[model samples]
Target: MDAKSSATDAKPAAVDAKTAAAVAAAEAAGPSTGESVRIDSWIWSVRLVKTRSIGATACRGGHVRVNGERVKPAYAVRVGDEVRLRHEGRERVVVVKRLIRKRVGAPVAVQCYIDNSPPPPPRETVAAAGIRDRGTGRPTKRDRREMERLRGLGAGPGGPSGGGFAAQGRPGDRDPSGGRGRPNGR
Candidate 1:
C-alpha cells in the first residue's frame, strides 16, 4: 500500500515485460543455428570465456581469431566456424557446433563447441623455482646465493665472479670512520 512497496511491485512487472519481449524476439528469429550471432556473445554463452566483456576485450586485443584470421567482437558466428581464443598464455581452439544467445550450464556449453586445444604445460613447483611466499621475510644469505646460482649468476656454478657482488665487496662494506679504531694505520 505504501509508495515504496508499490514501486517494488512495479519493478518486477517491468522486468517481466522485458523478459517476455526478449522471448518473443528470440522466437521470431527461429533456431539459433539458422541465424548468426555475435562472436563475443557466442563465446560467453558457450562458456569459452568467463563473460561477454572479456570476450569483447580479447577480440579487441587481437587475441581472438575466426577461421584463422583475427576478428572483431561483432563478427558474426555461424555453425562450423572455427574460433581460436588466446587467453592467459594458453590457446583454445573450438569449432562452433551450435549457436546459443544465452549462457548455459557447463555441460550444455561443452556441447556447443568442439574443443581441440592442446594439453596444458606442466606446472613448476614453487620450491624448485626458489619462489618464496609473501610475508615470509627477506631471503637469507644462503637463499640469495642459491637464487643467484639458479639465475646463472654468482660463483656457485656458472658465475665467473665470486658471487653476484664484486670480488672486493660493495662500497658500503668500507669502514666509514676511515679505520681510526684499528691499531694499524697507513
Candidate 2:
C-alpha cells in the first residue's frame, strides 16, 4: 500500500476507537435525574408519531414524561423506565423495554417497547375528545344523537370544529388550504 493511503487509514481507525471510548464514558456518567431517553429521538424511533420534530414538540407541550416527571429532548432514557404521556386528552403510560437509537416503522417500534396506554376513557371523556367515537366498538343510538347535536352546533359547514380539531399531517407531508404550515401539513 502507498504510504499516504496507509497513513490516512490508520488515522481514521484511531479516531473511531477514540469516539467509541468517549461514548462509553458518557454512558457511564450516570443520569443524575434517573433513567431517561432522548425525548425526540426515542419518540420517533418508537413510532409514537413519525418524526423527531414532532416528538420534541410533544415533550415541549408536556405530552411526554419520564417516571412521572416531564422531560425535555435531552433526557436520556434507560431500560425499564416508565413514561407518562397524553396525546389528545386521555393519559397514557409506557414502559421502556429496550433502548432504540434509530428511527423505525410503526410495527417495529411496537416491538421495541411496551406501551400501557390507558384503557378507553369513560363515555363522557370520549364525547369531549371532539373526534368521533374512537375504538368505541360500535356507536349506539344515543351517541349518534349527541353527534348530530354537536354537528348542528359546530361552526364549520357540516359541524366540524376549528383547525385545532383537524387531523395532523404526517412527518413529511405539506399543509393543505394554507400558505404556511408544517411539512406534514398535507
Top lDDT: which candidate number? 1
Tens-digit lDDT track of model 2 for 48-129: 7666887788899888988988888778888878878676666767887756666644544565568788686677744453
Would you list the clashing residue pairs of candidate 1? none
lDDT tens digits, residues 1-186, model 1?
Answer: 699999999999997786666545544443543567899998998788898999999999999999999999999988899999999888999998877788766656676789999987777622465789999899998888888778766666335665445555565676555667655454
User: 163 in model 2: Cα distance from truth in Å?
Assistant: 28
TM-score top scorer: 1
TM-score of each: 0.62, 0.46
TM-score, predicted candidate 1 vs. hidden true structure = 0.62
Native-to-model Cα distance after best TM-score fit, residue 69 in candidate 1, in Å: 1.0
The positional error of residue 1 in candidate 2, measured at the CA in angstroms, is 62
Model 2 score (lDDT): 0.67
C-alpha positional error of residue 44 in candidate 2 after TM-score superposition, expressed in Å: 1.2
Q: Show where candidate 1 strays beyond 4 Å.
A: 1-34, 124-128, 132-137, 153-186
